[model samples]
Target: MTETFQISPEQAEMYEAKYVPAIFAQWAPLLLDAAHVTTGQRVLDVACGTGILARSAADRVGPSGAVTGLDLNEGMLTVARRLAPDVEWRHGDAADLPFEPDSYDAVLCQSGLMFFPDPDQTLREMRRVCRPGGTVGVQVYASLGSQPAYGPWVELVARHAGPEATRLLSTYWAHGDLDELGRRFDTAGLVVEDVHTRLGTVRWASADEMVQVEIEGSPLIDRISDAQYTAIRNESRELLGEYRTDTGLQAPIGAHLVIARQR
Candidate 1:
């Protein structure tokens, strides 16, 4: 069966409330730093996903600079607009950006490249809109194997929830190969300036919360059955014991941040 990657407004809200703090927000500053975004520079955050990176970019660029966030999902854009009324949030596809050539000083896509049907074309769009001497940065999760906790969680879900659910869960870390990612950027005519990994901690209040976000905060919400959810939660209590702390469940999550320039 074909799997859908989209999330609903409710899911998007939960994502902003739960997943962002636990994960995506941590990478926002790092990605902006890698892109060297600064004051008085126009920035475009493609696939902005509730506008975490866009809002962060806004802070970096200040009032003089402009930031526009674009994404295909209206659900995500809706929540994004509510959070930051000042930023320009547009509904558009990443593969075909509705913007003029050389429209931005910096283009960013954080943790969104993996879901694009045509990441190469999307990168080309990013490069196209970026003016000369500007930067383009994209961040993606490293391979599931490299992730200390999630790899095993994926395995547990696969064994209990079956392959379709596993497939959907794996989409975030689908393109972990640095060489391949670099090649995609090169094909889009962007020079690869740097490609490196950044490590961060993913902490959950409890095993149930960890499993809860895995389902509720993503498209996997409706796909997983009650039994499957229960099984994963029960298994995680013991399976992920080593990574637990007095505070919660903490694990080292690594993601690759790639900074490129228009050729």
Candidate 2:
């Protein structure tokens, strides 16, 4: 039996609507490029939230090739299915993939590495499903301090909402150190071909919307109080002032990209 991860429908919808466009979409191309995804090739997007990466992979591979997105969250899979019914979606644990061995030409994971209970096991599973010499790409945020606006946001949340809230937000940037991550790949028996940092910008209509999405669109939903929300907003307005633009709260965000080949 497969283990299911639960998230609210509203949160899943919010993630598809706000987080994907603002953040995840920007990194899809990077991962695809690193994996060298091309036409007529089987691709698996592990932890494919809302299926942006899988949908993008589908476009690259065309109809001849196949793309499957697997995630633990049924709610996310629901939204993903609604968005792109053509692509296959599955709900299962990342640490334990349900597919057969050597099943795909390439396997890609985006911004989902940190949250896994056992990242090394997940990478091992990703490698197991990829054919020998095929590509396996993974991306994780560089670090909380390295990311622009979010670091301060986490700090502000800590001040108001306490350590648990801060921990929830900070998890986004976990598993940042390159050496440590590379070792996990090494331990998983994946041959590291390249590793580097990629940067993208996050823009929200306002600091409030940015904060709202980061909190409400995540597990932090209902975990914070109205007074706390008010404090976070008021402080972020001044704290994140430099990132403000005509469009919204814009800031440079970065992630470490790893391209490894199955041996």
Candidate 3:
């Protein structure tokens, strides 16, 4: 059977309600600030999952500026629409964006490029939609080596939940090379600009809750067996014990913030 990567409504709901606020929301302002987005500037957020960045961009741009969010998954778009009904949310792919050239003042993608099938095409599309001197920004997770907690998680998952489960969960850290990222921007004809390395923190209620929501909201749901889950859960409980804090499990998540100008 073909592996399923897209998420369902239930998974989207879980991700938006739990994972987004805890992890993804912190990086939105970084992209906006780097892009130097101002009021009355039209912006497009590509692969806008649940509109976290789109909602932030909407607020930053004010009512005068337009904000449109595009995503390949209907489930994610559904959650995004519900969050910002006023903001335009469209269903579309990143590689083949349905927009005219020189259409927007700024184009942004947050933690979305790593998931696209053809990131070069996606970057070119992001550049194409942006006008001359317009801004385009991309955000993706840092290397797995930097995040020590994830290394163990992957190992534990491999030992319990299977290697495919580990691979599915490791997708976020796919685009970790800064040099390669800059090359993509250059290849897309976007002018080189500032690149920022940001450290963000994600604090969850507990390790159990963290892994529970991840397993539920992730594409690994149907792929893993119940026995595997039990094993992983038992093993993870012991493994993640070190990460627990007095308040919650506080983990440092690093991201690369790249800002490019459309030429």
List the global CA lDDT of all models: 0.88, 0.88, 0.86
Q: Give per-residue CA lDDT, model 2, range 1-263, as digits (tens).
A: 33445888778999899879988898999889887899999999999989999999999999999999999898899999999999999988888899999999999999898878788889999999999999999989988877666777787888898888867787778788888888999999999998879878887888777777788857777787788788888998888889888888787888988999999
Q: Which pairs of residues clash in candidate 3, taking residues 3 or more apart in a chain or in different chains? A: none
Identify the candidate with maximal lDDT: 1
Regions of model 3 farther than 4 Å from truth: 1-10, 159-166, 213-235
Deviation from native of the Cα of residue 145 in model 3, angstroms: 1.3
* Per-residue alpha-carbon lDDT of candidate 3 for residues 1-263, written as tens digits (9 for 90 to 100): 11226888888999898889789989988899988988999999998989998999999999899999998888998889888899999988888888999999999999888778788998999999999999999889987767667777777877776677767787788888888888889999998789898888887898777778778868887888889888877887788888788998877778999889998
Model 2, global lDDT:
0.88
| Distance from true location, Cα of 96 in model 1, Å | 0.9
TM-score of each: 0.88, 0.88, 0.86
Model 2: pairs clashing at backbone N, Cα or C within 3 Å: none
RMSD of each: 3.1, 2.5, 3.1
